[model samples]
Target: MNGANHSSGNIIRLLQSASANAALYESGHLQVVRLGNQLFEELSALLEACGELSLIVVENELIIDGRPQEYSLFINRFTALLKARGVEYLKFQKGITRQEVASLVEFLSGAAGEPGEIASTGHLRFGYLTVAAGGPPSDSKGGERCAAEVLKELSLKELDRFTEIYRAVQRRQKLKVSGIADVVSGFVDLFRQEGAPLLILAALRDSDEYTFTHSANVCILNLAQAMALGIEGQQLKDIGVAAMLHDIGKLFVPEEIINKNGKLTDEEFDLIRQHPVRGARYLMDIPGVPRMAAICAYEHHAKFNLAGYPKLPPSWRLNLCSHLTMVSDFFDATRTRRSYREPLELDQITTMMLDMSGTELHPVLTRNFFQMLSDLKTPS
Candidate 1:
């Protein structure tokens, strides 16, 4: 109905047409060539418009971009074809060509022996969905699970791990950077498999889980932001780790003061403000910890304009990772309900973030963050 849905449906139609033609005729036949050309043109236009086109198979459904399409003969056959080839996900980039489309259709039609037999090109990529099976029992017939369930289970496990890590920190134990890296790596894989940012973020349900839950949410948001900026590999994981530990200094602050519902005395507030420096120092002492983690922990509250706590020299520039964590921190903090205040609506939070852009937040990054949110919300 809408432009996004229309484009998605059109692409699927062209793909089905091309694959059907390829199955009936040779790859170089006139009809197969025409269908491949049409499909390539459609995919190229879609990629140019959206930057990337991701087709993910979640159980029995086909997810184009982030939205699952209605079940149809075309979708059913295509899903079966991909499942037969052990290909659960396909991403098309801007430089995809007609020849690549032909090859893809040929592979889908069983002309190619296996997925690996046809090496993925630069502009076309293939991946298999690795859905976690440990989640609660599925309600759907046949017991098939969905992406949201997988994310929730993984998020809860990560939260439990972070809770233990925080308690260890409170007991003055050495921080295990390897454990943090493992959690970040899991999140990166989850983000890659799951296309929707909103769906990847863990919901904050219980106030008691605030400390670790906030950390998890911030880590997810930071990963989404980093990936949107084309950051990948170890750099992406480092940013995620930085976000996870950004508030580690709060562990040193007394719980009574940290969770107090009433206004804090000036001394209490001052102690609260010292968390950044304290967290940074603690991280600095840990071997194998990413340096960016310490920097982010220290500068997350240091406003973009250098107007917020633990004052640094005006000439010093903030680390980009810290800037990212700061934005995520503010977003998750304002959105989650706390003892002192009720959670704000999404509209209010976005408006406030916009108002603080260029002052409390990096202007371009702030806008980019919102744009990412907008894209996720758009029907695809």
Candidate 2:
């Protein structure tokens, strides 16, 4: 078996043994210690498999190490025990101790009595194994950009909502920023605490769903880049909203053309090119939508070299947010999966972006953007 499968089996065994020990601990402390020692060894084995253990519960689903564990009797029991105590996520690093295992057992046994109790006794942080769930896990510098299950689920849901709202706006209905606002805030909160770089948790983009996923992923990328740029508050929120809705006009184009697996005719290509204007108009008509959003929607397709469609004045300077969104939109588009082709690798994408810096992208912003990506890739 592969290492992941082997490790997953070990995790199942660990959960089973831990749950059993927790249930039996009150009867005999010595027996519990022995069982807990076994559990500690199990964890050590799994830690040796992967660098760390990350457990997440989304509804009834349990995911470990970005892969879902197979469902079985023990998994069901494990889920029930955690839910009964309001525990939703867990993480463990190397060198976990036997005492920590024993404390975890006690916490799980008593946690059921407290409503929404996030952590176990002795004030053990969830990641540290006293076993409670609250806030984002403490971040380790240059760590993998894994996010909480709640945040991943929330981002997906918000993407769905954003797509629906875009359809409504395309139908000439007014846009509501309330749902979008909440999603941006949630993203900001998680980003600040988790320190995860954008696109880390993005789902693979299918051909038909490219617009929706791309919009959402661009927003995530944009938010991270913006945060790195020291942009904050209302401006940050506006940028996120705008980035997510950048391609809203694509909804006006025929789906067949968008999803075509072959080359497009000139007419079809022109219709494809009109999305920026169409999307910008949609946003401009909305009352609460910011002007920057409309401008970004309009100009996201416009080249930094002033060579793209919907030609503007040669001397016109685009908004800073527009420049940022343009880079973000291009990065996400090139990296998106499609029926016609696979997504590009990060090194290739970064190289391509850097090549386009002076004439097709903002030189300074592109430099900073790639630097941030490079920093994220280095081990801390």
Candidate 3:
């Protein structure tokens, strides 16, 4: 390995050891303190050499200083711990102190409070990585791309990653919930920072991209609505994941049936309609998959009046997360170009949603969704 890679790997190993020691012993334990000091010294030297030290966890792998690390047990354990604690990125500035390093180890070890409590201090910073538009810019003009263009590109890249994750679910591979979490984290950060719905929503470039784009858009819309209602942190992240995976059952349906240009026969349509149950069951079986995701997967299509599908009992109360996902799903599906129809304008979709309110959709949530949209449209 090169000098940079070797140094980064060693630092991560030290971090892993320090965190383990912190978890097993008291804060002032000699081993923990010693490891923390060593970690501080090593990280300081590296930060001085490189100006900044960044460790990002992407898809369960570590990306050190923007370069991916070679897979190893230490890398896996360290990244897993970070992800478990909802941290996707860590940045160490040159002036970081030994005390701050010790605190970070404790935080990573779960001995300290939540990740949010220790998000940043002095030279230590940690949070989700913004979903990048792509690799380095092609030329000088690339720096001049407008915010919308950059967001659209980032949305497209996220769509590609989501599609891969969806395919993995279809193949019955272990669901990488971390991948979904990372995508949701990006949306959450975008909402928190930019707070512009239009810029965050992806434009449909091709009909073939609709499935993933629709899910991605729904996630964006759901996060917007959730944040407006004061939902934050892990709950907000769970809602985003649920919205993104609400349509995953469609992966089990045959491609021919899903992409049919003509009207579907009853049999094909029945199969299509069964996706909710299939998706819920699939999600429920996966360990660490949020129960909200399964509930939303099953209930998003069930309608507010309980007249939609799966023939639930009259007393079945839908989950709040499911209600939110339903509103987002309907909005995105109507706004996007489909095989059977062209995309609807905002006004047309608004009218349709208003007409369906309380019967096919939740009355309060639907109105809140539109009111949020109206607020977005109105000038400041």
Candidate 4:
């Protein structure tokens, strides 16, 4: 498996390929990985410090195991370099010859060139940060994002590792138990470091992609409701953990069921209903997952009207955190797309949620909840 293997049972019927056929192996070397003025230099220094890399591909992410400490510093340097050249990288990418690239690199490095006038080409080339593409532009695709720009923005924010971790989690056959805990830890740390509520809101609402972002958003909203109800400290963190994973059940649901194109049959609905129970079970295995976290997962779907699942013990009561989690969970879910149903616009989602407050979500938390995220979208 150390080599590229091509097979076509084309039943050569008459012809066969010879392993010894030098004629068959043209272009034997791997393609050169082009670098901008920045990444090229970083890669050079890193290669000089570390020997050959042990290439390991787990889906779309990369890990260079030999140089552990150097990796972080190299990534940081690469990120800064990319950010400095962000928009420029996306602006001029076509008919760019090798000499042109070299000239551009020299200009970026501030060497001895009177800056030549760049003709507006109306097309930009891309670097390959996009996992879908191999980090570089293939043939020019109109209006496609430049991979370098995306990497540059992420580098500025110091979020490359987060993106890497998230993609890695998504690629695994299943999310690892340890991985989920690690991510949830990162979420809590962000909350702790945040001094302003606006920062927390922006961190959730802006920049983050759909799935993980939505999950973290709901958890933050749920945590706010906890504070309004006077929950504090470790108790608050416990509830945050539960809210973060309210949908762990969906991870186990078939992609078809989760992405269903339209209304589901009663049988399909039944399968969907099993997620709350499933999610609670998965969270139960994690070490130190408080009873509050597990219980919220178990009962977040159970209604205040007593119309939801795992019918409460004769006296099994829902509490502040559980009720709040239910509200935030649905709020983000409605704003998101589904297989059978397209997602509602934000205003439409809010209006519908407003209508269901007292009966479904807790009335007071629902009221404070709207206000909690009200200052959210306004520019700081």
Best by lDDT: 1
Global lDDT for candidate 4? 0.49
lDDT string, candidate 3, 1-380, tens digits:
27767777779899999988888999989998899988988988987886667776645657665344666787888888888888876878788888788778888888434544575887887665432233233332322233445356465567678788888877878688888988888777766555454445533334276777788788888887766554555667888889888988898999999989999999999999999999999899888788889999999889989998777988787777787788988888877777788878888888999999989987867876776665333111
lDDT of 4 by residue, 1-380 (tens): 11111111110100111111212333232221223323334333333443212211111212122111122343343334334433112222223343443333433333123333333232323232212213222333211222222223323233434345445534543334344445555545544544223234443444445556666667766665554443444555767777766776766677687777778889988888888888788667756666666777788899766578866664555755677788888877776555456767767867877888777776655766666555444222
Query: Which stretches of model 1 miss by more than 4 angstroms?
Result: 1-147, 155-157, 202-208, 377-380
Ranking by TM-score: 1, 3, 2, 4
> Candidate 2 residues 156-235, lDDT tens each?
56667767776777676787878777777777877776565553434334324566667666787788766655455666
lDDT of each: 0.76, 0.68, 0.75, 0.49
- Clashes (backbone N, CA, C under 3 Å), per candidate, total 0, 3, 0, 10
TM-score of each: 0.61, 0.59, 0.59, 0.50
Clashes of 2: 3
At residue 269, give the lDDT of candidate 1.
Answer: 99
Residue pairs with colliding backbones in model 1 are none
lDDT, candidate 2, equals 0.68
Over 91-148, each residue of candidate 1 has an lDDT whose tens digit, in order, gives: 7888888778877887777643543455779988887554223322323321222334
Candidate 1, residue 291: how far the Cα is off, in Å = 0.3
Give each prediction's root-mean-square deviation over alpha carbons.
15.0, 20.3, 13.5, 22.7
Residue pairs of candidate 2 with colliding backbone atoms: 118-132, 118-133, 119-132
Best TM-score among the predictions, by candidate number:
1
Candidate 1: residue 133 lDDT (0-100): 30
Worst 10 residues of 4 by lDDT: 5-14
